[model samples]
Target: MAAKRDKRGLSQYRNEYLAAIAATFSLLATVAAAGWSSPAIPALKQDDSPVPITANQGSWIVSILSIGSLFGPIITGLAVDRYGPKRTLLLSVIPLAIGWVIIVFASNVHIIYAARFLHGISYGTAYSVTPIYLGEISSNAIRGSTGVLITVMAKFAFLLEYSIGPYVDFRSLAWISLTFPVIFFILFFWMPESPYYLLAHNRDKEALSTLRWLRRSDESSEQIEKEFTQMKALVQKTQHDESSLNNLFARSNRKSLGIILLLSCGMQLTGINAILGYAQTIFSKLEMELNAAELSIILASVQLIAVFIPTFFVDRAGRRPLLLLSTGGSLFALIACSVYFTFDAFDYPTETLSWVPFVSTLGFIVSFALGLATVPFAILSEIFPKSIKANANAVFAMVTSLVVFVVVKLFQVISDSAGTYVSFWIFSGCTACTGVLIHFFIPETRGKSFEEIQEIMTVESSSKEKTKCLPLLC
Candidate 1:
């Protein structure tokens, strides 16, 4: 009887873990497309390249993916709400596979541009959908672990691309990267739809059934029924609330949106994309003895290792502490890079400090993967009510893409004009300021259920109002 009562045990998470891993394959494909430019651009600029591209064209190839990111959210926002996350995610695979096919047969830079634009669309869609899907299916007990997989899978994909892209021809790399989307579609097609999505659509019976499967419990199980009842009530409440852009940004949700935007900006402006996009380029400029490709592999390997740290401790340590440590660590790493570049700019003897750039960069990647890379997405999945969750995610994802575009586009210009030290200084300042803001503003969501998290956001918003009134009262 005691064993029968243990329906919510760890064994219940087996299916949820499986489903989350399947969703990550889509993310793998998306990140591979984003990082492909890192390796493929160098090959394209080679004198004997098949599709010769100027440096200007190469930059467009990388940054235009962010342009595609801009439009992907709109499609995902519409499709995800109507068709549900599973189907919407399946549909996203079309553009990704098509994009890779175009790349495989590309005859010119313009064709590659179109292919990359499609890749960006998939990038935006995957980021918007995967977290929401994982969050909806997972119990609060393992939600952080599942949600952090998004970053872990993305880092793995980046590592895979950097490891493989340098050795293969551009077309061969395209052929290899295309397999991820195909595998995602195959694996994810059979997974159950989110119980929340099913309930929202008035498929309560199916919702109950999916909940049972996800929890590995029976229809007659008391714990499963109780859990299903709570989920149904939350879904019913959110489904009745009108969803619109105005409603999403209204006072009730304004705080969540603000937090998401801050996290998104901090994640991008601290130089993740710029570094990943230009790692080899930066290393080559320093005349590193290890060669650019070897250094890039090392950088990516470090990222793969660092990103795994969150999956183990996110739930145990909580989001706020990891995030605080991440920003603080990143602040120091960026300052180190800025200081080194400052010394180099002054033509000081830096022969002994050749390792600073690589070491600082590795430090930045580790700090980023530990929290900034993972926690934001986990918080994203927790904070929003179901009524506007998809809309909020789409908005957050779109803003993330736009910011990445600006950073990637300007990194080269800034480094060329004012020197790389200035770029690092700018990033360091941004990280410091963002960290302070996050410390004061962003609330922790570890171990919080969707309903509990909504209540916390509402309370926080109300407290903000009361604090504002206290000043006037005094």
Candidate 2:
């Protein structure tokens, strides 16, 4: 009986993990939509390409996703009201699937751009709702690890695009990308909606069912009942529409929103999207002996490795320290890249240091993956109150997409006007300033429960609410 009970416990854990992973397929689909341009750009720019685009046009193609994504999160957030997180996430796959199929037969650049934007809507929804779903379902003990899966899956998708995209025809690649979402919807069909969502809707029994399904069999029934009761009480206590713009600055949640938004802005300013979208353009500008496509693959591989580091450390080391480390390291790496470009721009005899730019870029990606790329997404779902959580995510996702649009467009314009050197200097400045801001403003969220995080935020908000000017930020 003891052995049978132990086996049952293991089976329960496996089932929970499988369900969580299935939900995360939405993330994989989001990334596949985002990363298509990385490899496709090079393929399109090839001499015998079917649709030849200028560098500026290529920038537009990559940035167009931002256009559609600006509206995606809010839509998904609203859909969560009627459909719940699982259905909202399931609905996200339809757009992605449709977009990929459009790409498969796209002959015109405009068609590709429209298809990208259409699909990008799902990317926005995935980032917004996926984190919330994962946060609600995940145990605090493993929240950091599970939350980081969004970033991990995204990087994995980026790598997949780079690896297979370069070698395959456009239609073939599109068909391949379409397959993941189909698989995702099939596997994710059985995963329950977020219990928190069920409880908020007053479906207590279903919430309890989901909670039990997500918990280990070895967990005491009393403990499970206690959790269910707490979820019910909290939902009843705090029930209200928290989506108003005024509530965005409400004394309680303002600080959490402020910090996460800054971090989100910083995430965009760090040039990750620019680097990924224009991997070929950036590599081609370098004085490397290898092909741009090969260099892009190398960078993607390094990025995939970099993205995995935070999963192990995020819960253990805490959020602020890693953000400090990542931003500080990225600051220096961006500066180093600036140095390389500056030297190359000046026509200096720098033949011996051709490797510096690639190495520095690789370093930036490593540091960025360690924290900046992963933490804000994790922190946002943790820090924000459940009342306004969906809208805050919507606004944040919208702003991120907007910032990414400006950054990508500016990258091409700046690289065309002054050079890559100036662009790196600007990005490094953003990193340096963001590092300082994080040090004084960002809170430590490791090992804290939702209630604990809220308590900290409430106290901090009340204390700091009096000051009209933020000392650290100002």
Candidate 3:
């Protein structure tokens, strides 16, 4: 009986796990669009190139997606509040499919540009709304695990692009990618609307029913009702308080926004987007025996594997330690890459040191995947009050898109003018500054309920005690 009970307890989360997978599944295509340049750019620049592109055109192709993404969050923020995550996400698929169709038939650079912009819109909408949806649907007991799925799926998508794009022609690759969004829509259409959204709209009965379906199996009526009551009360309180743009500056919300922006900027400024977007081009500079495509696949695989570490341990080991450790490790890797580039820049013999850039990049990916990639995103869903959460995500997504655009657009120019060594050194300095900010400002939210996390944000910083290490970090 004891063993049977334990098995039943584990089975209760089956629907939650399935819904999270289906919702995030379309990320495979949108994210693949981001990294598609790694392989496609090289092909486009070839003498036999189907649709010839100059280096400047290639950079635009990569960066324009970010600019297009700026509109996505704005739409999602407005629509999610009025409509609901399920419907909003389903509607997002329209732009995504249209983008791919354009790409498949694209004959000119301008056509590809328009397609990428549409892809960016879909990417932004999915990212902006998915985290909020997952947070609302999941029980606090498993929220951390569910939240990390966003990054996990993203890394897997990057791997898919790196592995597949190299072997296929551009149009063929686009055709292959188009299938993912369809798969996501088919799987996710049947999934339930978020219970929190229902509660907020005063549809208490529907909210309760959805919660029961999500929590299926031997869960007692009283337990489900108790949970439903708590959710309703929290939603009611937040509705009464009612967040607005003006109140977004209230002490707690301002701090949360600051922390999110800092992490977002840090994640981009550290050059992850630039590196991934131009992985093949960056590796080509080394003149290695192995091709750039193989190296990119390896790097993406490392990132995919490293992301799983935080997925398992984030709720258990906590967020702060992993973040600090990831930052420290990334700093060390950036310094290593910078040193290699510096030697190469000075015309030193680097043939024997050919392995350095590849290895350092792998190290950076591993460290980045451990925390920077996953933690800040998870924190985005946790930190804000429910009233302001959608607005906050819009702000976060828009700012992040802007920062990524700047970094990716300039990386090629910076590398050409100042050399790769200069870019890596700048990244290291940014990483160091971000580490300092994170240490002092970012809070640990592991295992906490949304209410508890909000309470933590409300307290004055001066009033709380300092510790030698954040909880579990020591």
Candidate 4:
């Protein structure tokens, strides 16, 4: 009887996080989409490549995918709000699969451009939908884990490209990349729509069923009903709330918006895009002994290993602490890289110190992959009310897309004109300043309920009630 009861408990839908897992497969696919070029660029430059491309043309090809994604958030935001997360996610798969097919048959840069833009659309939809769906489906206990798992899958995708892309033909890589989305569609088809979305649409019966399915074993029907009622009430309340771009200009919303933009911009400003785009050139310039491909694979492997560190700490250590650590370490690493480049520029006898670039990059990746990469996202979801999230996310996505383009395009221009050290110095300063920004502006969200977090963000404490200055968090 005890064994039977345990078996029943284990079989409850709430006990399983299969839906979240399936949803993340789409994220996995997006990572593959983002990572595809890292290996393919070299292949395209080779004389034997099916379609040879120049560096100037290649920059557009690389950055244009981001350009496609620039419009994705608004489109994806509307789709999720209207059609719901599951169906919206399903929409993402079609474009990704089609993009791969286009890539497989590409004889020129134009076809590859078309394919990458399609992939960017898929990526944008996943970014908009997956976190929202995952947050809705998860128990509070599992939310941090799910977020960390996302980081893991993203790094895994990069590793997948590094590990496999070099050895395979471009057509073969397209075929392999194509399989991820097909697999995602198959796995996610059985998953239900987010219960919150169902309730907002007045599908109360469906929401209740999903709620019941998501909360089982120790949770009674009464408990499920109560939770469902609360969700319904929140959804209804938020429905009447304004989410205009004008709302983003309000004092409270501005603070939130500021944090969002800083996180988004800081993500790019820390120089990860530049590093990934020119890892070979950067390493080669430093006179590293290892082959470019070998160094890249090693660095990618290190990043894959390091990104998992957040999953263990996000809930326990809190968000701000990790962000501080990540940014602080990044500052130190960036400074180290800058010093190495400074030394190299003057033709210093640095044979013994050729490892500095490699070491600093590894440090930056490990630091970045941990709290800096995932915590902003986890906290971003928690900080906003359901009412403003859609608009806020669209803005966040646009800012992210715009910054990636500027920084990536500028990285090359800056390196050629001034020197790589100038960029690294700028990155070091940004990381240091972002760490300070997190200290003053960001809140610690761990151990707080969503309602509590909202209260922390919007409600000024009595100690400051008479003060005229509006603070981010009291």
TM agreement with the true structure for every prediction:
0.95, 0.94, 0.95, 0.91
Error of 1 at 244 (Å): 1.1
Off by over 4 Å in 4: 1-16, 218-222, 286-289, 459-474
Which residue segments of model 3 deviate by more than 4 Å? 1-9, 217-219, 459-474
lDDT tens digits, residues 60-103, model 2? 88888888888788787678767888998888878788888888
Backbone clash count for every predicted candidate, in the order shown: 0, 0, 0, 0
Rank by TM-score, highest first.
1, 3, 2, 4
Rank the models by lDDT, top first.
1, 3, 2, 4
* Pairs with backbone N, CA or C atoms under 3 Å apart (clashes), candidate 4: none
Residue 72, candidate 2: alpha-carbon lDDT:
85
What residue pairs clash in candidate 2, if any at all? Answer: none
Q: Name the TM-score of candidate 2.
A: 0.94
- Point out where model 2 deviates above 4 Å: 1-13, 218-220, 240-245, 459-474
Each model's C-alpha lDDT? 0.88, 0.83, 0.86, 0.78
Candidate 4 C-alpha lDDT tens digits along 356-410: 8899999999999878888877776666777777667777778888887787777
The TM-score obtained by model 1 is 0.95
Candidate 1 lDDT, tens digit per residue, 285-364?
67567889889999999999999899989999999999999999999999999998999999998888989988999999
Task: For residue 312, give model 2's deviation from the true position in Å.
Answer: 1.2
